[model samples]
Target: MKGWRAQPGRLAAIALLVALALFAIIKTDDVMRANALVAEEEAAMDGAAILASSLSSELDKFSLLPLALAEDPQVKALVAGDRDAARALDRRLETLASQSDAAAIYVMDAQGLTLAASNHALPTSFVNSNYAFRSYFREAMDKGSSTQFALGTVSRKPGLYIAARVGPSNAPSGVVAVKVEFDRTEENWRRATRGVYVTDREGVVLLTSEEAWRFHLTGSAPAAPRDPAEDLRQFGIAELPRLELPLAGASGEIVQVPLVEAQQAIGPAGWDIHLIVDPGPRVAAALATGRLVLVSIAVVVFAVIFALFAANRRRRAHEEAVVAQRTRTLREQLSQANRLATLGQISAGVNHEIGQPVSAIRVFAESGSKLVAAGETGQAAQNFSEIVSLADRIGAITSELRRFGRRQPGEKRIVAIGEIIDGALLLLRDRIHSHGRDIDLPEEDLRRVTVEAEHVRLEQVLVNLLQNALDATDFGGRIAIEIALLPDAVHLHVVDEGHGIPAASRDTLFHPFATSKDDGLGLGLVIAREIMRDLSGDLVFDANRQHTTFTMIIPRHR
Candidate 1:
């Protein structure tokens, strides 16, 4: 009887040990699975955010097109019933649309009649189409500008239409619109993730990687009910099909449906991008890792704890040393990279500075050859002399580039303002004649004023400014150079009859890589400003002027 009682106590102790082991295994698995799920959710959310940003960037690329087109003189004339401008405007719009990779660009009259379109040559062209009922057109006419996503009435394709009102807001003449499609964006999303979709404020899917989910509603009901007629016009469907995504269970238990979802807003648009992720593999791996950890803890509890602790301390120290070495190496690499970047900028500057002289040289050479063939010996000799001067200019440019690379300052001396102006104009004479643009030089006495500066650097700055003016001015446009003598400084103003710089671009006018020209490197003004500052002078823009103006201020030579 005593032996039986003892056996019952032993059995109870064994049962208690088994229960504790089971509890530990279950607890470890739960914790590990939960952590893994959280990590997966976070990663999915980050991915969704990145995708949303990309979509926003894509949309932004074409957002300014309509506004720019709205300001076009040809578009304005066409809107004013100038039928002769339609042919030229159509070709220009077609070229612009092709270059910008936009789906379509079109101009509409006050009646919302498409007057000209980029696809006017095609059979399905938007020309002659009336979009008076379209929200994009109506909204733009009322609000000055608007963006609307809808299905194309004729093409039956979904795209975002960005529209801007032409002329004054109070009496708008017409509207300019650019359509941007998300075909490439959707393709990229399809390759990057599964079950990616974008929903507007009404929970209707506007864009999706899965074609079947497009135009589907997100929840049981729309956020705001839309008019049936508007819904039909926008999406070609009055009743949108609900999206049926497999969602995870609410109990925090790993269920058979292992999908996790994340949502991110795209720009100011009340559109949300959703990314769906499958966490089945991650959860399984976490469970396996937990089981292994439990086994390891049980085996190493008493025997290897102290040894492991000491080894861990040694390993940490070694890792710290390694990290310090890596940091030093990284710092050295970064220094080297900075040096390379500086070298690249210098090279780009040299390349840009040399182009004008080289072009002038070619023009002189060609003229000389033609003159020689025509038996005009004196004129040919003059052309050859100009070529030699251009070659000398090239040599000076190279020398300056080398000195700049070495960080050596150029020697400054008193130079007449007329000398700088004459040198720059001489180099660009052929270009000026070819473009039929005129330059109004300062008065003879005003040109006599002297400034203290490096001759080559000052001439380079002037040349850069003149070249920009030449580019900005239209054929037969006039550019005027005016010199004003201050008590301690001389101001050289370069004014062009071209369109003034937009207010939005004024902040970055002198910043590197900020340019309005399509083929410009955006380094000329930056280099010119730096050169002026180095010479104890300054460069500034006059924003108050009706025309474009750049002023260079130099210390007056005593």
Candidate 2:
């Protein structure tokens, strides 16, 4: 009954019903809009197909005219025996090239010998070359007034060849071939918004509305034309017939006509036409209107729901915010408590550490006062020496405390690793002497290696590892310290003969708060590792033989 107040529950149920109804309506509208767009695109593609068929038919008619002209008596005489055949052929070619979109013309004498070529200036001499192996040759001699698409070897041009034989055919007569440049026809077709090309069985652009390049297999080559297909290939147009996979330059509709499979006219060759389409006006308008309608309905539904549950929604939101605030406050308070507990432990250590230095100073002052009261010169000198020693000890303890408490400096300098070990040992000297632990030093000649580092940080790292080794070893147990100089690095080792670090804990010993000590802050090794890394050195633990060796490696150059 806590959340069952009639106003909030009833309003929530009513809002849910309204939301579901609106969602259904919106989804239905979206589906309808998508289907309509698809239908419009299909209609546009059908129109492109009709245009392609009409254009192909027109090209078919034009292709036949070239063959008909080749059969003329005057053309035959010029091709067969005229000594001025080159000039006549030139005139005929120019006429044909101008009359139609043909690129060039050539004639063959009786017995299938090349007579003359239209483009005399062109470096191709087609004279006396049999046209027997060519597609146009086969069509003219056997098929009669036929056109074929093929790549010409001499000129390296791909075009349509319309060929015809004249006078005494079936025996061996003259032949004329008209070369229609498919590239020009392709260029004209490309001007439309949606356009494509068609080719015969030989991959020649027959009825094309798109730009294409020429590739010939024969004839003295002319200057190569600029390639338009370069950019088109990058835009995925080279995958033609497969062009319908997606629109190239823009989004919307695209269609492809696989002339070979779809129309069955030139099936062997990969002939196809592609159509790029723009959306129709009606479909565009429909999409805009549908979006507006959907938005309006969403607004109305939201308004009605808000009106029904205005007060209750406000109350619930406010309650949730208050609860969240309380939860965050509790978490913060718990975190603060944990921090204070940590501070308490560190404070106790600080007090114990400082007490020793303060007591020693007090004892030294008392002894100085006793010597002053006695007024004995030699005894006074001895008391003064004692005071000086205590003072030095106090100073040393204070420095170590300050160093441990303070932040590290950013400046770096060349520091000898042995110097760091000496500083740490000085601070531990009193404790080491009191415990009667044996300390060893490297031989004078072996301790010459130096490395680039922060001196204070290197000392701190050494002290941390040394203290851990001391705490682990029993009284009178051996703890060996060694410094080995290698070619690249100087290795500092602290090995303890007491119970070695457990195999499981060895890997994570350098991690924060990882310790075996009962009252351990668990931060010493962690801090050591961090400082070593800052100086481009590393601290690692190794349990090679029986001893647990903590090795600090500092690179000589770094």
In terms of lDDT, the best-performing candidate is 1
- Pairs that collide, model 1: none
Candidate 2 lDDT over 404-501, as tens digits, reads 44443336777666677777776666556555677667776556567877776677666667666777777887777788888888888888787777
| lDDT for predicted candidate 2 compared with the true structure | 0.62
TM-score of 2: 0.39
lDDT, candidate 1, 1-558, per-residue tens: 999989989999999988998999999988999999999999999999898898888778888889998998899999999988998889999999999999899999999999999999988799999998899899999999998889999889999899999989789999999988889988887787756888887788889877878898888344676788888998899977777767443233556536999999988666889998877778889999999988888778755767878899899999999998997576445333432343463454456557877998889899889999999999999989988888887887665445333322357888899988886665556567777988999999999998888775676677778878887888999999999999999999999998778899999998888998887656667767877886899999998888899999999999
Query: Could you tell me how far off, in angstroms, the CA of residue 442 lies in candidate 1 after the best superposition?
Result: 90
Taking all chains together, each candidate's TM-score versus the true structure is 0.50, 0.39
What is the C-alpha local distance difference test score of candidate 1? 0.83
Off by over 4 Å in 1: 1-18, 220-224, 245-258, 298-558
Which stretches in model 2 have alpha-carbon errors above 4 Å? 1-22, 123-130, 188-287, 296-558
Give all candidate RMSDs, comma-separated.
27.1, 17.3
What's the CA RMSD of model 2 in angstroms?
A: 17.3
